[model samples]
Target: MTEQRVAIVTGAAQGIGAAIARELAADGHKVVVADLNLEGASAVAQEIDGVAKLLDISDEAAVARVVGEVVDEFGRIDILVNNAGLVPFTPWEKLDFAEWKRVFDVNVNGLYLMTKSAGDVMAQGGYGRIVNIASNTFVAGTPNCAHYVATKGAYIGFTRALAGEIGKHGITINAVAPGIIASEGVLSGPHADGFDYVVPMQAFARRGVPSDIGPAVAFLASEKASWITGQTLVVDGGHTRN
Candidate 1:
């Protein structure tokens, strides 16, 4: 029988993060829905019979506290999904230093802090899976979103380097880069018009959804991917054929 694992998915209040949380739960793993939106996280937790943790991943103190609490309650964390991030659409000329910092705070620094804290615990346990959420824009390169793409590129680099360092402890770290997913946030945000432009470009000729990403994340978190590490699985329905 396969042992039930404990997972922590950040930014799980909605969108891709929420879908990953549900997918992991359906796989029979005890999931922790961590998000800044406490109510949303709690609701998802109830739906999946998992735990809800209010977290601001950019804050080092908050990240440490959540890791400690989860470890104390669950004994060990087997999966850590760094899915929490910010996506801002602004032209490069208008993208100020403050805006760039804010984006990196959640996308880059947040992932680093979470990985450092959780990876330490996983190293001690001698088994762990770290899956980071990146974007396909880093490969194809998009206009008006340089900061977001740079952060994802940083994630890929970090995953490769960290995997080499932590593989000795049986911890595998990888990344998933999704195309323009039509999640609730994108549908109502300024990027709605982007779908029309993106769909025609995709080889699949369909808009990507949140569910499309869940299974991929689940696979990376599974024992079946034991030998896979420091890789980026692009799930964009062949949008960016890299």
Candidate 2:
């Protein structure tokens, strides 16, 4: 029998995060749906038969508390999915410093905090998988969202550097870069128009969905991918092949 693992997925209240949570649960991992929205997180957790944790990943105290709580309950964390992030579609000139900082706060800083806290627990266990959610925009240099793209670029850089530092401890960190997925936030946000623009550019005829990202993340979090680390698997329907 395959041993069940425990996974903590941040920003898992809805959209891609929710999808990742569901996938991990289906893979037989005890999932914790951690999000800023307690209600949404609770609902998803209930549906998936997992735990719901209210978390502001950008907050140091919140990150620490959640990590400690999960470790206390589950005994160990096998996977940490840094899928919590904010995407704002603003022109470069209109993007303010505060907005840029907010993007980094959640996307970059929060990722670091979770990885650091979870990496400690994984080190003790001598096994862990860390999958970061990056974006294809960083490679394509997608316009009107400089702040969002920059954070993803940082994630890729961090993943590579951190992989080198943590590999000796039996923890592997990698990234999955999605290309213009049609999630709830993206569908309702100003960037919705870009969906049409993306379809024509993609090699795949259909639009990218949240589910398309799940398997890649789950694979990275699985034992099957033990040999892979410090790489960014782009699940963008071949939109911007690197």
Candidate 3:
């Protein structure tokens, strides 16, 4: 039987975030389902018998307050999954500064703020696991997605650097770069339109799902990953491998 632990997963309302929350809860962690979508978050949290929190990852004060609440209620946070991210498809040739900043605000800056606030609590506890969600597009060099790819690239770099700085504190920081997760939003959004033509993932035929990325996150957030940091686990089912 798995030991009971407390976990906080950001962006837990939908897509890969929801899957990760369910996976961790199944692993016996008291999962905290957090997202900007309160109703969505509540639904998932109830499904998993966990708590829900409405959070804007881009806001530092909100991040601090949410993390603080989790610690206060759970007594300890065993795992911190920085899964909140935004993937705005913008071409560099026409990318406006505002649009670029908006992407970074959620993807890059949000990750950093969460780490800063949550890292302190984890450090005090003397042990923690931090699994950051990255993207395989950065690895595959997927075109026409300059902003999304760049933010994820920065996340990978941050994961490695943070791992180096926090290892001594008994916290591990690693990243999971998943291929196209065929979530409801993805299938109904831009990727479903004409975005699939350019980046051909013919080998897999079908797109990757949330469940496909869950186990990787669970592993990285487990004690088994104590010594594994400064690495990016790419789970694209050979989509980006070619």
Candidate 4:
């Protein structure tokens, strides 16, 4: 039997992150549910028969510590899913500098910290798959979250640029840009009211759920997508097709 790959999924306490964790676990990988919510993370870990980690990806020390702990326990990290981010829905007029900075701190800086830390371990192993969660708002130019859109645009750019450097090490870094996913965060926030208006805009009339995104991430993290790197797979129900 092939050995199970060790995967660390950030923001896996709920919503799309939790769904991704479930999919990875179902793939027979040893998944680590890493999130700030200890209770939620632990619940997901128990369901997957995996480990739970209290991680704040924006904190440099916390990022290092979690990576170190994963390395110590698993000896190598095979996959990293950068799914933790702040989704602020403030319009340009109400968008203050503090809110913008806060969003960037998690969406961009946290992404960088996790990528660097996990990537170092993957380099040592000479094999890794890094999938970043991005948003289609960058493409659609969705209003009322300019900061969020900017961060996701940076993620797509980062994925493309970093893939060149990491591919030499047998690592593939790609991104998944979701559109109008009805995740817990969105359901409880401002986007909940917009979906009725948003669904009709999609190639498919139905709204997207967390499960809709999980399989995409699993495929990208799998051996099947080996040749595909530096690409952004937009899972927006064909909403932004070229």
In order, what lDDT does every prediction score? 0.94, 0.93, 0.87, 0.94
TM-score of candidate 4 against the unseen true structure: 0.98
Where does candidate 1 have its weakest 10-residue lDDT segment?
184-193
Under the 3 Å rule for N, CA and C atoms, how many clashes does model 1 have? 0
lDDT of 4 by residue, 88-184 (tens): 8898999999999999999999999999999999999999999999998888998999999999999999999999999989999999999889899
User: How close is every model to the real structure, measured as TM-score?
Assistant: 0.98, 0.98, 0.95, 0.98
- TM-score for model 2? 0.98
* Candidate 3 lDDT, 116-184, residue by residue in tens: 988888899889899999988898787667888999999899998888888888999999998888776
Once fitted onto the true fold, the runs of candidate 1 whose alpha carbons sit more than 4 angstroms away are none
Worst 10 residues of 3 by lDDT: 193-202
- What would you estimate as the lDDT of candidate 1? 0.94
Report the C-alpha displacement of residue 164, candidate 2, in angstroms.
Answer: 0.9
Clashes of each: 0, 0, 0, 0
Name the TM-score of candidate 1: 0.98
Query: Which lDDT value does model 1 have at 68?
Result: 99
Off by over 4 Å in 4: none
